[model samples]
Target: MVQARIGERLGLAPATVSEGVKRLVTEGYVEIRGARDVELTEKGHLIAEALVRRHRLAERMLTDILGMAWHLCHEQAEDWEKVMTPEVEEAILAKLEGEPTCPHGNPIPGTSSGIPWSSLEPVAALDAGAGGVLTRLLEDVELDHDVLKFLEEHGLMPGSHLTVMDTAPDGTILLEVQRAGTNPARVALGRNLADNLWVLPAL
Candidate 1:
């Protein structure tokens, strides 16, 4: 129920949210201990809570201390979400003693433990009207130059809008994304790249 509620609040589907819960279970981080509810095991609670802490703190640090625009901070925070170390997170918290939440008003992850959180699925899995912020892109050259160029030229970096237009029978995904103003640019994201790029639902 908690996972489902969080998903609803974030505008993501329950299935997608379940993926995160399942990963936590597989890693011994969460468990189903009763018939009526799911509970985070101690290990699960620590990791999940810590991630929330780091994410919120990072957002606060970026916008409050560094003066990043609200829209501009998501990408940087997304990258930091995966890489924040316990020590680094603590240092940030200590530096900003009164900070308790992200600029978006969500609670921060409480610890800096180096646990990797679950990421959103690829663009290919997305529905036509659904949009999300590109959170991360694994680096590759020969396999990804076209997609990268298309993304860069159109301003489709992490935190940019990614809306699927049409999916080809052969598996190519057509995407429409926002540029500098007004209309969005139309581009085709091939199957390989689409499968690798992960995103969080757009706010």
Candidate 2:
């Protein structure tokens, strides 16, 4: 992701993001590939994988153990991930039965069960009347607390069955969620949110 986008996601000032990126580049964690693009180096990838693994595991621990709401796990996991040691991570993994993904359906790195992106399609691309089981929320979407809360409130979590009801001229997708033992509920999602939602089409 670009520095500007990263700053937006983290709610950091532009100067802070620039300085942080510069420090990362100097430390050999990131590389500037183009005028506005940054890529992680091999060393950076390893560190990122460790952080992501711990973060996802932390989310699982929070939701599965403490019964934390799924929408709240991401923020809490941020603090947990930083303090988790390798031993702590292993303990949590064992306690959680080595779950492959976080509460939001994002895969934990090093879990050896990551899903191939090729097998999924963005919800925005689904035709009206088409339906599928929600598979995951994109990482960027997971960072948006409002979006996460909205999705959770509407029962749009992973494994939920949803159908595309209509697409408005403004690119909003009207959807109907098929909750077990209940009548379907209609919800409208904007293009940005819909684009970040991936689904496994009904077979």
**Model 1 accuracy (lDDT, Cα):** 0.65
Against the true structure, candidate 1 reaches a TM-score of: 0.42
Instruction: Give each model a TM-score.
Output: 0.42, 0.91
Q: What is candidate 2's lDDT per residue for 63-95, written digit by digit as tens? A: 998899989999899999999999988888788
Q: Per-residue CA lDDT of candidate 1, range 14-76, in tens?
A: 888778777877998777655425587888787777766666667667977788765555556
Residue 67 lDDT, candidate 1, scale 0-100: 84
Candidate 1: C-alpha RMSD to true structure equals: 11.9
lDDT of 2: 0.88
Error in Å for residue 132 of model 1: 34
* Ten contiguous residues with the weakest lDDT in model 1: 108-117
